[model samples]
Target: MNQPSTPASWRMWLASGQPRTLGIIAQTISTVISLMCALLFLAIAFGWYMDPLLALHLFLGAILCLAFIHRTGNPLGTKNMTFAGALLALLSIACCGYLVFEQGRLSERLPVLDPLTDLDLVVSVVLLILVLEATRRCIGMTLVVLVSVFLMYGIWGDQIDGPFYHRALSLEEMADHLVFTTEGLFGPALDVAALLVFVFVIFGALFDRFGGGNFFHDIAQSLVGNQHGAPAKVSVISSALYGSVSGSPTADVVTTGSFTIPLMVRDGFSKVRASAIEAAASTGGSLLPPVMGSAAFLMSDFTGIAYSEIIIAAVFPAVFYFFCVYMSVNNHAMRHNLGASNKNQLPRFWHVLRKDWAYLVPLITIIWAVLALNRPAFAAALACLGMLPVFLTKSQYRQGFFKNLIKGLAKGVERVILVGVACAAAGLVVGTLSMTDLTGKISSAMFALASGSYVLTIITAVAVIVILGMGMPVPAVYALSAVLAAPALIALGTDVLSAHLFIVYFCALSAITPPVAVAAFAAASISGSNPMVIAVTACRIGLIAFIIPLIFLIRPELLLQGSPTDIIATITSTLIGCWALSGVTEGYLLGHLSKASRWLLAILTALIFIANSWISLAIGLCTLIFIYARRHQAQR
Candidate 1:
């Protein structure tokens, strides 16, 4: 008979046949590196001053080392370092070390003015190659390929004979701009990743580890778990709350969907519908406030906007996105007669609050720090510190407090690897664009293609952003979209915040968009449904997300950019419009909607979304009210 499995045996299995000593050594090094990285960022957040580029190099080096040891494609797996990975890890450290060591000299040197020494060139080239490889390993080839294409353009675009051609940089110029200057690898993207995104990720990881995840789930269950389609509603509420902190749709799906999807399926939700609902809800989390996904922080860096304003602007749209999902799930549950969960099967609200109420303080602390204090990094750090007391509240957590803290640090660092690499890689793309003026050319071409029509230009820009978002992480997608598409929208007279947020929405939606929907595919493994089917269903459920951006773009009132009365009116119309759209998507509102009724609702949704005056709002509102009234009377 086979022996029962233990954690030690599981570790051995995950090591993939590596020698026991080697595996142990790799794990030790990984843990040490994780702690060092976390502490490094924490120190900075608490006002430790270091040269920004030096700090970024140290952070990137640590991430690359972690990426090599942790193995690609398996985030939660044990360290399985091989000879090749070990060699690459050493090279990463050496290259990054040289930069950190020479930061003082490099900082004083001007790009294209001071020539790079032979050693400088070698380090630059080696570091670039290591970043590319680490990016491929951590994020996959989509970003690697995109960065490679930009690097090539930086080298050879001058030889091309089209609208896209630009002056090329020589080998030395390329190396100097990309490596020696802050314009390239150590640019805003990586800077934000190293500074803001890392601390927030740490806070999120610790918050979840120290009972926040359970609190959110229990609260969601208490609110809706005994209602019709309780599982699906629970998924939405829990995911939104968790995703707001996690800032990763795919991670959120894996975390919440593991419990929610199974419950949904057991409760008679179709596997595809269950997976799709979870995917849609999780994807919206990155769009939620306070500690949104890494990309939102990058948006703040790129646009020079305050992080607080970005979250505030995002509130209405994010809430509406979840509202639409809730409505769709409710309609589905009602339409199919899905049974309500037994009250005894769910956690009691008061009991959960009494037990886990402390978990909420960190979240409240972070939000207050960001919104009131206007210091996002400081807020996140304080939240991380605040989680310490919460861990002590539980006897189980207290017994292993230090162990769990180390694990949370390691996990948070592991999570930051993807964003760090993506940001570093995106730096290459942004560097190339800045050097080559590709952003201008693309924006001009898009304008010309749209015949100077603002609406057409916006349409063309959205298509470009969505296409670029496919098979890419949100940070990379937003980076590319901001450079490639946001310029066109801005040039077409869109507000800077709205243009970037527009890019953010679609980049996020790409995770649930068909063909390459990463979040949907993540749900597929749990729900045992076809990934494509889940993607399609997710799009239907998240239909309002796709429309919300366009609505806000046309009428900024929805984004809280108008007078109080205007904001109120726009929100009211949008709520009604979203209700109509939800009904159209799920084929139920007051009751099952007929084909004609769906079509009518669809038209009303369009009118409401495009409403530019009170008359338009009045018409749509009255029609929606009449339809609901008529349906209620018919049912009677």
Candidate 2:
């Protein structure tokens, strides 16, 4: 027979020859990374300083991402690739450990090792290549290509000979700057990942593996299960709650949509629409507080703001986004008579809460520590985590408590490694900007390109963020965009909070953005609908949520920064804006909206968004009265 094609031939040879070995090796490395993380987390939770912890995280990241290359592989895999992977993993552990051991010497402000150790130089070059390869394997070729372009720019910036050009730098100088300093791979991005984001991610994993999902279900069902479109509404609320913890929108969909989507279809919704609602609601979860996952922690690092302050700032937009989804589902219910269960059949909210109310104590503790005590992110999460053992006292949780606890801890470790690796990869981009001072160049380019139109600049910023976010996870996308795109907004007078959340909002939306909508794709797998169809529907269903950041930009008060009166006013108008916006998008109000009316409602909503607070409030109130009156009258 003719030789198989390259992909098939590779698979055949790999399957027969090296499959089990690579698989075993990858699993073994992943487990070790998990174990290392356990040690590191315990070390920090017990009150150690963060300097050494950073080194341990980076070390595990290097080893884990390299081994992921073996697990996830490339076309170039060979018997040699496996050997090379093992060698790289071992050397990486040694190299990153060396950096950690010598962090005092490798300080960002300290003098470079002028000549550089031969071993350091070799490790830097080899480790950089391996990191690039690992980034390719775990993230995508796009990031690898983007980082390569930055590396090239940092090295050869002098040749450009323009306002953007920099002085000549030798290869050794570049390597020293990129490797031995915090200017590159072990910078703020990784620092935040190690210090805060990793801990929260572990806490989230632990919460989920313990019983967070069931609590969300009980709570959501109590609130909306008797309403019209109960299934969709439940998805909205539950996804928002659970999504806050599980920042991966696609994973959230698979977890909750497995329950919500089927019920929606059985309750008179189409598969596409059901999937769209779940995907959109799930997408907003990462924007929710507690663990806005990586973006929120990084925001704290980037803004030099306290994590508690960031949490407070984040609450209104997150609530407003979910409110928009809840309204859309409520509107659809009115239009289709969708959500009614017999009151008798539904679980009583109080009864459910009383039964598993213990499950909520951890989250409540976390929120209280953040909002009330102003504890740091890690401390807040750790406080809640410590209370989890309290659940073991209950008979319902006693069995398998230790078993699930260990598994949850392991899952957290695995997740942090992924985040750690991504952060290291992000640091490459950050380092290039700092080393070459390219941020100023790029910001100048954007300013010139926008020609001073603030709206166009903000739009361009969002587009850049969305495009960058298309294939990468939100944190990686946010990290890159914070360096690349967020400056455009800041240059145009957007505040740091607005600029950061502005990027984060779009990155979360990317889960339902077309062409590469990962959450919609997961929903499609469940609903058996076309992913593109689901994505488009999701954009329409959640379209109002898309404008929320803009609303915040229009009125900073919406971010909870201004006076209580201003904050309350902005929130009231925005909530009303959401009602009109969602009504327009769903083509429903109290009852089905005429097409022309939807257009009118949409235009009026946009105007409400840009108007002065009083005017916006007036318009918002009028729009709400109009929709609510029509629906209420029709019901009568």
Candidate 3:
């Protein structure tokens, strides 16, 4: 009898190494571990009996192991494991395993009251090192260095003479606080990551695996592929849809930009402008509602706000963000006289809907479950489960269903390791800040520096968030900002929700900010343009994003915090302001604008956005009308 054939995935796994059996075993073990961890979180989401600490320990352990196995080196370049990586992976297992077995006993021991045993101390120290190392490997040195600074501060803070100084912490005290207690590596940040964020990541991974991405792209193309500037508009719509679920702007650019950027260039846009447009559009995805990025989940956890409430409040700002992008693209298309896409090449809207409409059910399930049922984690879990029937309905998905399920689950776990490790690292920062009372000191320093001016405080916070966000991921940036700058904003009389949302806005924007614009860089790779040029163009295209956060900060009604009339009025004025700003930025309204007209429009837009009163609104209207008449007379 002929030997049975190995599965394609198994063959693919074994193709990476010299020892076939070893590769098979390693792949099997990793897949099993990932699945088991995923199932554990799923069970916990369904109210399974497990200690929260144990769950976090399991999550951190498996993620660290996977991180070491999949990535090597400090800057995280290599995808294959080396001997050193294997050793680190083993160490991660042993260290985390100790806590996993002893979690119950450790949980009952009062932190700082009960002295740790030698082995306990050893495990704590090793686990802390492993977390930092894994963070360095998976995320990069930026976060690792930030976490290290916090650790060093926790150790020698008492030696400092300034107001920032705090009481000294011993090695054992630091280890116990960060490793043994829930306040450190196992805090709300990790808790949220292990449960809420992980489930959503799985949902997104499986959704993409099962053709939701194609469905979204097709739908967008069908809707706008025949319009002028069709490619850029498709990038905005598709990236917004995908980014809502994928939640990573860089990943969104890589996924959708591969198609949209080339199309934009083919249509008429410059390579740099095309890349920048995609980057800006993808960056806005995290701010979109229904299903937002992982940082939004962190926001819900950090602010004690419901996920549904956050998404609901995000509606106006998110809409206005896309509106600005769309208006900018429309003007550019008009200016360049870009023609509509070939009608024959566009997908039929009804045909796409009729065929792939089932893909939307999972997304709708998430929105309904979160809003109607108020169970965000369960909502994500249900969406993942809901994908099965939808997958079964399609022959391509139904074939090799079991293998695809395994592959999707494993890929989901792998994809989340960066986020998981980042959250754990963020926990270290939060733990240190809490232990040292550094957050209060920083907030006080900021307050004094701003001299009790809320606008100045906001500006300072924005600068800090964007700078911190430069090389860091959104989760880390938001976590750091939430603890540091947000407290300052709240102290200066900003609303709690607004302050946190303000931090989130800047965090997302940093992906396109210059010097280290991750999203723009990713787009440049596809567009074959200079990354900095793309970053500059993206900043111009996304200028409205920077302003929208400030608008909501001034008018809380923009976040749905006021009466119906107030909400409506704020949204209307902001939309008009965004339109005028887009005109100023693009130098095109009814026609190409002269420098004088652009300046006049810019001033009126500033007046409208800054004053937020009837007089400003009337003046803005008159200015717009005057500009329109002048342009019309010129056209005649």
Model 1 TM-score, 2 decimals:
0.95
**Model 1: residues >4 Å from true position, as ranges?**
1-22, 73-79
lDDT of 2 by residue, 1-636 (tens): 866468766544333122223456566666566666765755675476666545544655454544443434544345333665566667667766666666665554444545776776786787787677666655556667778888898888899977889988777787887776666776778777776676677777777777778879878888888889988999999998888887778778999999999999999999999999999999888889877756888887787777777777889888878888888888877887775766787888899877777776777777776677664554645554654654564565577776676677667776665567677777888888887888877777777878989987887777777777775677877888888777778867888888888888898788899888989999999999999999999998878667888888878888887788877778888888887887887787767888777887888798788887778888888887777777687788
TM-score of model number 3: 0.94
Q: Give each model a TM-score.
A: 0.95, 0.90, 0.94
lDDT tens per residue, model 1, 45-67: 98899878789889988987777
Ranking by lDDT: 1, 3, 2
- List candidate 3 segments past 4 Å from native: 1-25, 74-79
Number of clashes recorded per candidate: 0, 4, 0
Each model's C-alpha lDDT? Answer: 0.86, 0.76, 0.85
Of 1 and 3, the candidate ahead on lDDT is 1
lDDT of 2: 0.76
Error of 3 at 169 (Å): 1.3
- Candidate 3 CA-lDDT value: 0.85
